[model samples]
Target: MAPKFGTSGLRGLVTELTADLITDYTRAFLEACPTGGTVHVGWDLRPSSPAISEMVIAAIRAAGIAAVREGALPTPALALSAMEAGHAAIMVTGSHIPADRNGLKFYVPGGEITKEDEREILMRLGQDWEIALRPGALTEGTQSAENYIARYVSGFGTDALAGMRIGIYEHSSVARDILIATVQQLGAQPVPLARSDTFIPVDTEAVDPATRTRLATWCAEHALDALISTDGDADRPMVTDGTGQIVPGDVLGALTAQALGAQILCTPISSNTMIDAMPEFARIERTKIGSPFVIAAMESALLADPQAKVVGFEPNGGFLLGFTAQGPAGPIAPLATRDCLLPILAPLTAAARAGISLSELVERLPARFTAADRLAEIPTDRSAALIEALASDPAQCAGFFDTLGKAEEMDRTDGLRLRFASGEIVHLRPSGNAPECRCYAEADSPERARALVEIHLGKLRDRLG
Candidate 1:
């Protein structure tokens, strides 16, 4: 398929993202969202990202907009720079996808492009456009990375992580060095582990078994108090406790929200239902499964009460701050974009203040275990048809979930989500960035939740066959 807009950005295979296509999309973005004199551009560690960045920069210059290249930075860092500078930005990254695939995330001066902005870009695509007679200037900058690191250090305090030995899984993430720097500035001993030269697609939400085992082994071998990492672009975070036990992203979101004293919270429906059980937030809002949806909800909350301390997060541990919050050191300016560092540092500092381990911090939350996995290469049409069949035919739905339990409730917010009589939830949706059908299950026990995901995805694969 051609490069198309997904949940948060434009994504497609590397081979399909030709120079002409990339330039056209950039031009369309420029037309769709006219900016000031400049546009910020950045990229990730993927092999194709540099060439893609070149295309984006060329397109920006052609439109008479100076291009400020913040090379090899995380998506949030780039967005933060552009937003603060009051300019539009584009990031060439595939996020957690494999090396063969890549994507481009667009941002306006306010924050990430909304669905309406996406529609405008789509409407302007492939149209003839005028180029400036004089190409705009091109320059480079490194302040984005430095500013990003300072964000965590100043917000969490210098000694937030003192006396803690943290492990950094430097697995080709664009933010590896920045993570190490931030940890050190917070007075933690960072042990760099598994630094990779090649890009490794590490999905924080659905970590593979091999990576899980590796995390545990590394934690024990290095005598680490906590382990931290991110995906290719470092927007989604992967954090583990002393025992290398992965903390669920939604759980991390709850902890971080409570730590920051947020009054309002917004998250997707795919997240663990246990969030509703948390009493820290005065109000909670659930939306469709994506950052854009959660962000929109957060904006509404802010509109209703501009002084409300609002926060948004995805199930992948990408946290968003909607208002300036008072931190241990001082004030943390709001950055209404998906971020990895805030979620990671907030939980660590909260646990430290409580004199408890990360695992113990998680144990204090409600016992709602969530597990997710995706069936690779399942076409979107096939997944949509399966969901439609099950939704329309009661008998088929019952037969499909025969061994599980009766379907007590169904939520079609973004996909097909069924609440069984036993309170277990099974949600199926086609991945926005790839040709995969994803299954998310939540149960009272971790083992049961994992089994539900495995069994449901197996059935999906068989049905596709």
Candidate 2:
């Protein structure tokens, strides 16, 4: 099977990405959107990424373009450097997906390649374009990691986090070492733990129970101010409370916006509802799930108010800052791509400035709680059919939620989000990155929100199975 485009880029099973396919896909991306003489290529910690990187570099060189390889780094790091150079870049990562899968994210100096851009790449590749597939040697550079760490250090300075203690969960994340280094440069004492080589698919959105227990335990054991982590590619963040529980990503976004005194915010509909109900934002826009949609929405908002400070985030805790904010050390320039560092630092800085703890800072928000989980191995098409049926007619999903209440209102913005008569809510959608059905719910109490997600996800598994 041919690899297909996902919300961020192209992805599929590792077995599906043959050497020839990788070369051709890379060629298609370059041929579709010509760029500078040099193309920056990076990869994640996945075992498949290295091989794919060589194939991509070979393709880049085959096109008579210079290929600058940066062994393995976070997607944001590579993208930011590429943006600065005004050259195109590509990242080989499966993101949070299982190690058996992998993908390539292409960036055109401006940022991530859009849905339409993928279409053009696919069209060019489908034109019977000939490709000679072979591996090639290239000097690996350290610019991606160096610049990424510098971005935080240069903007935040050396001691805003002086008194805080952080536990960095280095779970095979591409940015593991860099995250720890960045934390230390801020003068925070960082406890590095559980660094692994095997890929671990840590979904910051639908956090697993083991991770939940471990973070809280780490805080108590080490007296940590928080535990910081990220997805495989380090775009999505996973930040915790002083008590060890991770704060939801959307909540992190709101906290960041409030701390930065941001004027405009763009988020996916699946984000915490409190974001929509919050009074802090002057302009707020909601789009379908994915970074492309959020970035596009941020663009429209920026156009309407050029001077407005803008930021975008997803439920998975990926933060995208559109303009310079009053960063701790100096003026932080715009990094209009998914970032993990900003989300972690912004909220911590806000809490520090306000004389509060991480949990306390989030607890001050508008009393709304959100929880999400997923049904694994469900076909995307099957999930789509189920979503279409349930969204159009609540009766299709009513039996599963019988204990709660009737579907009072339905929102099909990006998925099937059903508001219950009892004031609880559930949003069901196919995972944009993998073969899974995702469910997110919100309620007045944290327990109820999580329970709703658990029950709904359980029901989905049974039905889909």
* C-alpha lDDT values of all predictions: 0.90, 0.85
The residue-by-residue lDDT of candidate 1 on 126-163, one tens digit each, is: 97668899999999977999999988888888999999
Weakest 10 consecutive residues of candidate 2 by summed lDDT: 129-138
Question: After superposing candidate 1, which stretches have Cα over 4 Å from the reference?
Answer: none
lDDT of 1: 0.90
Q: What is the Cα-based lDDT of residue 19 in candidate 2? A: 78
lDDT of 1 at 410: 95
Stretches off by above 4 angstroms in model 2 are 128-139
TM-score (C-alpha, index-matched) for candidate 1? 0.98
